[model samples]
Target: MAWLSPAFPVGGFSYSAGMESAVVEGHVGDGDGVEAWLGVLLAHGGLRNDAILLAEAHRVQGEGQSLEEIISLATALASSAERHAETTRLGEAFVKAAAAWPHPVIDVLVGPVPYGVAVGAVAAAHGVDRVDAIAAFLHAQISQYVSVAIRLGVIGQTRGVSILAASEAPILDAASSYARLDLDDLGSATIIADTLSMRHEIQYSRLFQS
Candidate 1:
């Protein structure tokens, strides 16, 4: 929780994962919309893929394998320029802050690591349960998007909390399934989310980075 929390210094509050764009374009307008949009992501989009990467990273780090391949693949999987920046920037911050735990995996993570890879690798090195790490990571992501929705005037605090409460099943399911799946299963089908993220890159006025 501390690692992926809003106060953890990943600058997560500044990125919406394209939620800002979704709101601006009317793709998401209220609590229901937020829930539905996030549901798609958790099941078939970036969040799903992130879960897979996190699981793989956890496995490799636990086995003391080099993370070069996973790192490269994570970067290459970004759906857009802003998406790329979001993951790498957050990953860098996560690694920097996670160094407080004093794990050798931190030093091994060179260059721009994706957020999932950093979290999974660090957590694995510290002996955090694989399932717990992925589930927490997914929850943090959903919470961030919920925050974005509230800030964008799409939902109030009460509604946002409800949305989070409602997302428990999807988060758990994704985490469970992805933890068992390998790299070959890493894929996203959330076209609208991906396109919104790309459109957010060039959006003339925007509150979030992506």
Candidate 2:
């Protein structure tokens, strides 16, 4: 829980996952819209991809598999430049912070890494269960976007909680399925979310990074 907390210093708050542009473009105008949009993202897009990566990373670490190859593929799978930057930047920060606390696996990881890979590495190093780690990672991602929704005024505090509550079943189902899959299963179909992320890169005036 500590690693996934908003105060963990991963700079998650700075990235909106394209929600800012979605709000600006009027795709997500209210709490209900925010819920619907998030549902798709959680089910088919970046969140799904992240979950698969996290699960694979955890599995590899536990099985004594190669971290380098996993990191390489995870980096290449990023759907957009901003998405790549967001994961790599947060991953670098996560690795540095994990190093400070001292973990054997952390010392082995060198160079750039993806956020999901970093999370799996650290969790495995700490002997955390794969299911628990995946759940935390998904929760953190969901919370970050929900926080963005609140900041964008698309959802009130109460509404944000409601949306989260509504997401519990889907999050569990996705996490469970992803945990059982291999890295080759990684894929995303959130076109609008990806478009929003791309559009955010050149958005004239933006409140978030990506």
Clashes of 2: 0
- Tens digit per residue, CA lDDT, model 1, 1-210: 899878898899999988888999998988899999999999899999998999999999999899999999999999999999999999999999998888778889877999999999999999999999999999999999999999999999999999999999888887788899999887778998999899998899988888
TM-score of 1: 0.98
Pairs clashing in candidate 1?
18-210
lDDT, model 2, position 32: 87
Question: Where does model 2 exceed 4 Å of error?
Answer: none
Q: Residue pairs in steric clash, candidate 2?
A: none
Q: What TM-score would you give candidate 2 relative to the actual structure?
A: 0.96
TM-scores, each model vs. reference: 0.98, 0.96
lDDT of each: 0.92, 0.87
Best lDDT among the predictions, by candidate number: 1
